[model samples]
Target chain A: MTSDGSGFRAIPRTAAQTRVLDAALTLISEHGVSGTSLQMIADAMGVTKAAVYRQFKTKDEIVIALTERELGTLEEALEAAEAEPSAARARELLLTRVIDEAVTRRRAVATLQFDPVIVRLLAGHPPFQQFIGRLYAVLIGDPSPQARLPAAMLSGAIAVGVMHPLVADIDDDTLRSQLLSYTRRLVDLPE
Target chain B: MTSDGSGFRAIPRTAAQTRVLDAALTLISEHGVSGTSLQMIADAMGVTKAAVYRQFKTKDEIVIALTERELGTLEEALEAAEAEPSAARARELLLTRVIDEAVTRRRAVATLQFDPVIVRLLAGHPPFQQFIGRLYAVLIGDPSPQARLPAAMLSGAIAVGVMHPLVADIDDDTLRSQLLSYTRRLVDLPE
Candidate 1:
């Protein structure tokens, strides 16, 4: 991973940065944080290690940038959730968007989110923590015992639903509708 | 990925197999399915890759054994659920047991379940699919939209709850109770 120092690659105005992100995401997905190297990313991209270094300074930066872009994708939905009239409404809205995003980019969501190394990074980063906190509050409600269990289960289900090995053959449309209907019951939202 | 074909370590026997399973579990949790290999398992076991192969004939078998063992841990609870006279009681029983396992295992359940390669195997495998069908049937009593939504959400929450980098700091008991309470509310189980 190389350093862009821009904190994030400014949307690949150039094809190189886009290639970097695309390659980086797949490698990162396959290799966890500590495991993925610039050489590997470069190899995957059919470029040299230095070629990767030119794109991002260090693996951490690449990871952060990758996360920023991925989270950036969720910004609109998150903003809409924050603006919703009630927590329930916020969750309902987020569920729709979350399902859409997960189904659309099924591989990326699971790989990026579930990577052990990324899991650590997201925890240590304040912005990530805060954003996740907001997301969970909407999905889980107040942190009370009453809300925590369902919240945990609901999130687990969604993460598992689309990517579930069992649900692989279920197709995007079916997965989307099933997830929405199932999670609607989870959060007690209307059909 | 060697296939020891030793059935499951959760059963009442075999110390060496348990040792192997324990090491494999820890390594897989750190490295993921595709990332972890037989050589790694051998090194972890302080044996040759051939020895690891002796326990399991192939990598896929190891994976199946691991999956079976994990599912086996939940078997007694599921059996109780099946045996229960009332559907509501069965649902309550299964959820409680599942929540209990999640809290106890903390990160293991979610991590292994989310790995892409393993997810495929579990789905493609008939026994796993059948077991899960039973699980959902018990968990989801009616196919109503309301019931399906919560079932999906609870499923997401449970997987996310224990392993979530978000809740990593929370103690197991606290996580367990919170998970139980929240999930109960989702299913509208008795407090």
Candidate 2:
């Protein structure tokens, strides 16, 4: 996890860290961070706790790694959004990728937002703070406190819209396209 | 516990049931339905678990009661929206009430979406299902599954946004105002 231009600290990963992260994310998504334990993760992966610990020193570390891995997938998009010539373009580009990634990952995104432990982790970490700022920057495109609600709504919509029990009947292709179209309207995107 | 709407089936509540529900919602919000046992609810209310059982037969009953209490709050607004002559007016009224109810009961609204048992409860219940459908009818104004994403996002933004670590510095007034502003954007409300 390398920092995007925004100086957000993302943990760059090795292949081993990647494997640990994949397993951790799966468990965390379903069971939530508090409900999920390291032992459960090891059992899920058929590994010993010691082996898992070698990859991440603590549950906090595992969470960080998992967050970093998820963010890492968005690194290219983040970079692109930052490099955009205008804020509108940045928001547009980010929204596109957000919808695409959301459709691809679906349930995982919804799960991440609701995990109390992960919520705490994101709150307490400076790098996570910076990364999230960068994320909102692209998501809402303004620093105005006034933008907070729209940003919140946009963020909420992305997380909940794709994975909602309401959307279960929606196919990925339709879900993706409809999400983008509606989101553009929400964000004031030009047709 | 009764179906207030959404696809969820709500348990019918009498006046006696309402007392048990109020106590349960407060406890469950803080502890989560799974983490919140009947002993905890009874302890919180200065009663024994058997006393709790007398009101409701099991933990499932309490969860249904708590959910119904929350959903019931929405029924008035849903009815008002349904009464509206126009889609735009219906969405407007529903949006305002949603923002108000969420802000007034910030903690409950925020926490309910994340609880494992509540999450499951809301999904399986039929009255909840119908209530949710009616609520969404006023909210998105169209049944586009694609349109559903923004609605979901808007819901999430209000529930999680004001409570967000990023926006912690924001006062309640600022949070509420900003959230309302941004949600309008997400739903493409007129400027």
Candidate 3:
């Protein structure tokens, strides 16, 4: 679990690669992976298509890197959670960080999770699949069939809670706190 | 409330228009609204682009109609839920049907809600806006800020729960039942 959560951060990128990923993330959030083009990312970054291609040879590489970066953000929380001895406490800690991360990125990360291309990438990408499996192992703890649904719902709730139109006007602090409490309830954690 | 729920169903369309929408939905489900083009829809339907144009003027029109058609499926449930006197009972009824609808359509309907174009259209389009408002109203009968978050989370839970990769292999009956129970818990209704 420790190694799995750390896998993403271990793969370092150059500053130029990071810049391309940042630009691609913005474009993909707005237009989705299927709708966004390499030329558009280059243009957004004020570079030529050749320059973008130099950084990422293909759109799929950019997408995989973007997902890696996003999941990397959770690496620390996951590490801490993995270290914690108590299952309930680990879950609570992870959920807090997860909610905060979701609120901070809001539309960008949540929206990316739903894109069809990204969905396929996440499934096929080995590191992502391993990292997600670790994330859910802590999230569900019990590993029973019944526990899986609530964990799935909890993940969906947090992802959608931060970005849904219904809560768009909510202040970051308010949304984060609200999500934390509601998510705690969903998992039957003491508020 | 009654009329708002029924608005989607009231809009009539020609058989040709429905065919165009059907093909458009399939393409949009795989490729997003922005990724899909009129020519693609026509190609899928084995018709010329001009014939597809005759059904709908622009890509946005096809998206709008596709959304309407999907929402129309929930019209009956919304109407039934609205007529129920008890708030908790109304919400229970709606969530059950929503879970069924989501599990039945699963990927297509859930994926559409997250599309950037559909999100914008649902926000800007008056009928879509009004219908969503009424749906939320029943879901959160309290009409308070506190209630809004749970209602928002409940919606995300249901949408993401049905379509999430983790639950993808779960049978429709199991998914639907699990969603109903977990969603009821999210809203603090008796399970």
Candidate 4:
């Protein structure tokens, strides 16, 4: 992972900062990044805009922080996959975690992943680019250029699978099991 | 397909109307629906806002028209698949057309699918909803609730696969082939 020229350092956030990020994420999910304002975040948290501003001075900072916090959830999972002795074991570990997170934060995760503002932010952010590279490395194992499509498709399937309207009525456990089973088929993992 | 309560009627557009849709799609792909306005569409089309307004009275109508034009592309494919003799053939036919469309208009397709405003429009519009349901029916073949997850995941994989940054550098032919191969595997279709 380190050899990819993208560092995997943890983004540390203070408790107060986390609170602001939490409120911002909730509002952003509903109104999107462009529509969300600091005042809205403050109102959601029942705090003055000044208090929210004390934690993050700008909306861009809050958006970046929220993105980092989301990516940070996968950090431990990435490390666990990296440490595994076998490639297959590593993929299994990482995918299990990815599915779990997707199911747990279904709406918020999809909103963030697909939001136009967030998409632009993630693309330009080196840390995010690095984190995504590491995550894909574990999932697809540095495939040839031609093989990148399947790798991309595999990740896409998982990300969009959880929040897809067809699966909206499905409970977490059933969605998790079916996703794993079908994903394994896509990736040619053993039963 | 009509028996499914969703009629597959073609949306007729004049050359001038298509010009507006083309300009609107281009801007909407870049700025999204909410951020885009009639003035931007007029600028893109080298026409006055009144000229654009003459074609469509409001921005919502333009958005809906753009969406209808896009979905209309799939109507033929869906009809062909519906006319197929076997379930397997229908799935294969539908998937092939889907991959082709996804690769051909990679950016526009993804931008429309994931855009929040477009998502809301699609959900609220009966024709779009009917078209999607018919599309899914062909893809999944009236699956039990447990089976909807794979169906959703399969569709998501295709939708997101072409637009994924990982495969961004890959050409259309390679992407189409790889997506088909992996999607076949996921759906248990014989390659």
Candidate 5:
């Protein structure tokens, strides 16, 4: 639960908040942010809408929390990459962790990334903007005019690669290995 | 419009149907499939819902038609690629055209590809399935387990690259060139 002067908030959730997020994430995956409602999250948890409201006053809050929680998973990896002495090593460490997380939560990750509501939210939200800035800084270094497209493509490729229907049958291990390899090639990392 | 034996129907849309599809694409880009309604489409088009319904009976049909229309843009490219004698040349031709189309209608293209409702429709609809199969076959040759991930990543990267906020400010020409360069790198295409 802290801000690192980059608008990065590390607010830890309470047990009830955790339950709401877990339920909300599942529903959002199936129904999307626009299709999902607060009531749906409540029903999924076998609770009243009021209970869900107590945890998150609005669907927007729930959406923000769910997104923050997903992004939070990458904080440690970002920090670890920041600690690395070599820029290349930092990029490698962060990319490896990113691929692992994307594969592990393939469905939820893609759902969150591609959902129009969530995409708009992330772009306009200061905290998310800051966190993502840090992420790309670590993954591809400072975004120069030349660097931006590759950075964008790298993130998009990995996210879409894991959840793509063509790769739906790909076991996590094979998918992860191929993703890392192709990702490295994209970013010019050593094989 | 005609269907090749691959279940890829090429039914030509009428003028009124074209207008509905255009309006629906704009709305879908902003609100996504689930959030958009016939009322919204009708309102956007300055018509009654009944009038809109005259063109497309269901939201699902609208979704399918929108998708098919988008895919139709690539039909010429796919045909040219198939006509090429060499597999590598075919892939190059298709990849170049795919990038061109993705860049030309960047917003609508990403919206169609990533929207959960549209994604589901594309997956469940047989014609879309066949068209996409033909698409990937040209762009990546085959769906051998090894080719699937790269194929998926290539499409994802280009789609996400064009629509990504990071590159939003980059003019389309610059964006297109960068995308083409990076995509070539990912697929190991000769520059």
Candidate 6:
């Protein structure tokens, strides 16, 4: 597959930019993008709003950067999956990695993935769309009307599975295994 | 099935309260609970902030009321499922109804269900906790730890399934059918 438009390459962030994104993501995960302000992020970092602004001029820019950072975590897995010869093996490899990441950020996954502002950002931004497209390609392995629902459901299941209150008390190891199994069931992949 | 903690009864709302909730839900769905304000709700309804204060004193009440109102939409179905003699039959009934509701409110479902503010409220609030307990009782039909992951995954799959970008373009009827089928698979229910 061509790397162009695939979002296979990670966006590089300067150390200062990384620090700004780190603080912003914590607040955004708790308060959401609209609820979070550059001032709050600055305060969280013990820096001035202008300092935060120096890295990201607007809240939307910070949000986009945060999304890119999150997506960057999966780039390696996505690339490895794409390189695999067998579709089933490719999906298995990607899903295990996805589940691991989801479990690691159980509390933040839902907000990061489902918050209204992030949802809008993901839909409107071409880079985010390209990244998601690449993820789904490995996920559903089909580009047809029939695959849309399972693809959507699987994505939802994984994102929601990690963060749902019903599973809140579940330890990460158990939650991760469960997410992998149930998501596999949703897509009819072999265990 | 004791009615005391079951949350089977829908919380009633006055006409004015309903107007506040309607306006609040619209705005909150666009901007999350933390992002939405009483003043915004008032402006959306073209009413003074004092007028909104008369109906509900704080933004928390509006959010709680919105959750109750959303749950109220499924009270009848939840009740029917509770009354069903067969466990499998009850799940089928509930899943179909849940799928229908999710399809109907595709855009708002993610925000209402997964927003960090709502998630915290649902977890910490007794009534919401009870309402969700009743829903899960019919959903998993078991209280074991084994059921936790599937329950969480099923809940996530449905909420995310309807609202996820991949399924955004699919028609409601088709989306509903797909959600029901895939969710049933996630829970090992027959199609």
Index of the highest-TM-score prediction: 5
Chain B TM-score for all candidates, comma-separated: 0.87, 0.83, 0.90, 0.90, 0.90, 0.90
The predictions' CA RMSDs to the true structure, in order, are 4.6, 4.2, 3.1, 3.5, 2.3, 3.2
Tens digit per residue, CA lDDT, model 5, A6-93: 5454468899999998888887877678888988889999999999999888888877777777677888889889999999999999
Instruction: TM-score for candidate 2, please give it.
Output: 0.80
CA lDDT of every candidate? 0.71, 0.72, 0.81, 0.79, 0.83, 0.81
Candidate 5's residue-wise lDDT over B76-171, tens digit each? 788889899998888888887888888888887788988877787677777677778888887777668899999999988999999888888898
Q: What CAPRI grade goes to candidate 4?
A: medium
**DockQ (C-alpha) of model 1?**
0.36
Q: Write the per-residue lDDT of candidate 2 for residues B1-191, one digit (tens) a residue.
A: 34433334334567766777777777665545555677887888888888888888887767666666665677777787899898888888888887777776666676677765567766777776777778877887777655666667666667777555556677777676666776777666774
Model 1 C-alpha lDDT per residue in residues A133-188, reported as the tens digit of each score? 67777776778655655565666677766664445556788778877876786677
Mind giving the per-residue lDDT tens digits that candidate 2 earns over A36-91?
A: 67788888889898888888778887776666655657777898899988888898
TM-score per candidate, chains pooled? 0.75, 0.80, 0.92, 0.90, 0.93, 0.92
Tell me how far the alpha carbon of residue A6 in candidate 1 is from the true structure, in angstroms, after superposition.
10
Candidate 4 DockQ score? 0.62
Residue A189 Cα positional deviation in candidate 1, in Å, after optimal superposition: 6.9
Lowest-lDDT window of 10 residues in candidate 4 chain A?
A1-10
Alpha-carbon DockQ of candidate 5: 0.79
Maximum-lDDT candidate: 5
On DockQ, the candidate that comes out on top is: 5
* TM-score of the A chain in model 6: 0.89
Residue B24's lDDT in candidate 6 = 87
Question: Which wins on lDDT, candidate 2 or candidate 5?
Answer: 5
